[model samples]
Target chain A: MKEFNLIQRYFTPASLAPDTLLGVGDDAAIIQPPAHQHLAVCVDTLVAGVHFPKDTHPRDIGHKALAVNLSDLAAMAATPRWATLALTLPEHDDTWLTAFADGFHTLAREHGVDLIGGDTTRGPLTITVQVMGHVPPDQALRRDGARPGDHILVTSTLGDAALALAQWDHPNPAPTLRARLTRPTPRIAAGHILRGRAHAGIDISDGLVQDLGHVLKASGMGATLQAGALPLSEAFRHAMGDGTNWQYPLAGGDDYELLFTLGEADVEPIREQLAGQGCPATVIGRIEAEPGLRVLGPDGAPLTLEQGGYSHFGN
Target chain B: MKEFNLIQRYFTPASLAPDTLLGVGDDAAIIQPPAHQHLAVCVDTLVAGVHFPKDTHPRDIGHKALAVNLSDLAAMAATPRWATLALTLPEHDDTWLTAFADGFHTLAREHGVDLIGGDTTRGPLTITVQVMGHVPPDQALRRDGARPGDHILVTSTLGDAALALAQWDHPNPAPTLRARLTRPTPRIAAGHILRGRAHAGIDISDGLVQDLGHVLKASGMGATLQAGALPLSEAFRHAMGDGTNWQYPLAGGDDYELLFTLGEADVEPIREQLAGQGCPATVIGRIEAEPGLRVLGPDGAPLTLEQGGYSHFGN
Candidate 1:
């Protein structure tokens, strides 16, 4: 199919948000955002070999591309509204585009995100998604708000996505773990519940340690993690086979979980609230008066990690 | 520098919009858009070889990437406010980045646009810019409002960029034409002026004939162009060094001028208004009750176009 036809057939139909004053088909889309709300915007890019392994399924690629961007909204405690996609493809394959559109629209519809506007081109496979959301004034979660002595917490399990990646070359990886890796859920609802509760929040796209380090740097604070307290799922254990491999979850990237910090006093009630929303929360550590992150072993001894988290550039 | 460090040094500094409640450092940028206005959003991508010749100056690449997106806002008669840059590079090149950022910020500062948020990755070189703008409610120019008796107009001149491209292999191309090809200006001022004066508007990115067809299709109208009325620039004429080479302007593209349709009686005043803004407008045609675009030659006979315009798919 031609580029214009492909978009008209697959994308134009899905851009039906009532607040979208103007959707696809124009040079730019016009949106009438609700009054008294600030707009939150972000953009993310995924390269075939660099971000994901080559030859990944088109559906998975589409899902993960938008999923990672939506995760940013979840981190900001904003409600996702609209997304624009820029896709560069090596070739035009109807089957690939059909499945990719299915994957993208499925996730977008769930979050009420409308396909507002975008551009398509001929090049190496790369997907860039810019998502816009709305957050009530003074209600957005920020990385700069982590106070010393605050309790650090995370939503859902960690390390499963990383472990699933490790099993990529295996003959048969656990379905649950693989889903965690390729179809990682964005914790939007958890974000909403934690909006007024959490002091700071960040999505763990680049591992828990590295991403949390951002919150620490932004807040000018430190943190101490209880390694045993990190949530590990049964699927992760099955994928790893034997001993504890905290490194995979702690330092491995693409987890897409929420790593947040809250006041010491507000933790229990917020935990209950999130659990009621089907997103259980776990207390991992506490923000410290010092200026670096440290993880304590089960015996309460300091555990040294080879690296904090993944970096596109070697640290 | 690492990806994070590169962004901090080069990108974070460009985010200075006071209305940008949150800028580059956060999970996503937050902006308190002025109340009572609609948000205009647009995205565009530039691939290394496909969008431009390989090894084009990084500054020109950056300028065009943002310029193209800004052009979309111009077409919509919107005031650009913020932009997110998603850059993919094969490797870290500090000098290239410095030049690119200089070029990007030069235009951004001119338009009061801030670089809010983005992602960087290692991959084939690509730059995707998503621009957000604002237009007052009921004041946006749309493509669907052209009338049968409306006059079609284009800002500045057409075909210079396309003509410059035709001279790409020439040893001594006109510097003026070269600049038009490399740095086509977005007629934002013209668009703003036409917000209320024009019935419909669009940018001439995809050749005049084809792009105007979109306006016609959207407005459910047809048009007739007096071939002698097509605006031709002296630089384009100097580049071509021939008589009546109308194809370059009529079917060639990368012209970021605002092509708008207006009521016949309103054309002269609007043209005078645009001229006062230093963007002279030209009346090129008129909307008709017919259902297809027709161009009349000096001989008063309809001319046949070999092709309507450039398409990603071969015609």
Candidate 2:
């Protein structure tokens, strides 16, 4: 599709918060900072050969880029307001640009986010999306808020994306497993519901076990997760056949779901509220005043594991 | 020059606006959006093998990436508040990361922009920077404000970047031309100075002749320029040997400067004030009542050219 055609078909007529004075199709985006809120902005980059395989579909690449940034916003409990997309394409293949723009615009609209402004240039195929969200003046959620007695809960499942990537081309892998790898959904609505309820939160992009370690470091607390209570999709169970692939679920990356902590009194009520929306929540662990994380089996014994999640610069 | 060392040495100590609550070295940077000012945001991406050559120094790559976005802030005449840098690298080379951070932090500090938040991922050598600038509630500079008789003027010289890139490997082109290509400074101070004084402005990233086309299209005005008056550095003259590489000057892509239009009455006074700061100002064209651009020769004849400037997707 042509550039203007793609924009009109996928990006126009969206409902942004009252503060977003102007949306997409402009030289720059203009936002009226809310009366008592501060804007939180972040950017994420996904390169063709490094972030994803060269042949990864354009739509998936587009979705994951925005999904990751939205995940950052979720960690802060910030309500996303606007986004700017900076896309670098090797060539202007109509089909690819059309699919990419469709995926990006659809996600933005679903989250009530506006596509304000960005730049497009010729180069290796890479996508960078910058997201802006709003948080109440003094109440922005942070990784530093977990307390000694906080309940550590993860929304949805963990390690599904990692499992999917491993079996992507494996013979006879079920369709459900492949979907986990290709179309992992970002929990935007759940994130919105989570605000004000969670003390500290973060989206699990890099395996649940590894990313939570960051939370532990930042909050100065340790965590204990009951392995049996760890959410696992059916696909993950099937892919793990003899359970040898279990490490994939604990250390894989690219699951854009939120991992958060809440006060003990707030857990059951929040779970009930989430169930009302068809997304029953799970409490997998608890934060201790200690300084490290330990995963436990049903018998309360430590579950020994070798690998952690993927690290960008870690060897 | 390890990545950690580079960040600590250069980026950590940079000055920041009073509202920058936390800067760099975190999962995400936090900022205090000024009480009454709105935020203007934009993102731009540059990729090796697309935006620049793969062999280009990491330092220059870092500089250009941030410089491009600073130009966007200049377009709105917004005071840059904070920036997020998302870099995708192929490996964890300490020296490369250090050089890149040095360039990024230096330019950011010079413009009073703070590095608030960002993500680092393993991928192609790609850089995406999202910059946020503050404007009073209703006072952002825009592209849609040129009047019928506003005079159009460009800051610094044009085409120098395009020329520089063309001769990037030349043993030694003129010093000015090489600097323009390797490091075309963004008009950060000039942009703030022009706020409330100019009607509309935009940074010249594409090319003088083409980028100005955006302003013309947005403002619904035409422009006329005296051929000999297009800003030309002595380096530009020396690089093109016979001055025939005008295409590099007119269509080159790396110069991060500003192209703005102001009221005819406001021109002389603004120029005089800028001159006091040692920044030479030039008025090369005027906003006309008609609908397209024209470059005039010495005898008042239209100076026609084979091509206008560089186009991202254009062949």
TM-score of chain B, candidates 1 onward in order: 0.96, 0.90
Task: Please give, as one word, the docking class of candidate 2.
Answer: acceptable
Q: Which predicted model would earn the best DockQ?
A: 1
lDDT of 2 by residue, A1-315 (tens): 001223434445546667777565444577886766666676677777666767778787777778778877776767887887777777778888777777777777777878777667666777777787777665656677788889988877777777667766677867776666666676666666776778887777777887788778778889888887888887677667765455765667777777889999999988887778776678998999878888887678988777786665664
Q: Write the per-residue lDDT of candidate 2 for residues B175-280, one digit (tens) a residue.
A: 6776777776777678777888888787777677777777788789898977677778876766557645556555565666777788978899988876776666
TM-score of model 2 (first chain only): 0.89
Give residue A7's error in model 1 in angstroms: 2.2
Q: Residue A151 deviation, candidate 2, in Å?
A: 2.3
Error of 2 at B198 (Å): 2.0
Candidate 2 chain A weakest lDDT stretch, 10 residues: A1-10
Report the C-alpha lDDT of model 1 over A175-293, residue by residue, as the tens digit: 89888888989999999988877889999988888888889999999999999898889877666677778788788888888888888778999999899998998999999979998
Candidate 2 lDDT at A37 equals 69
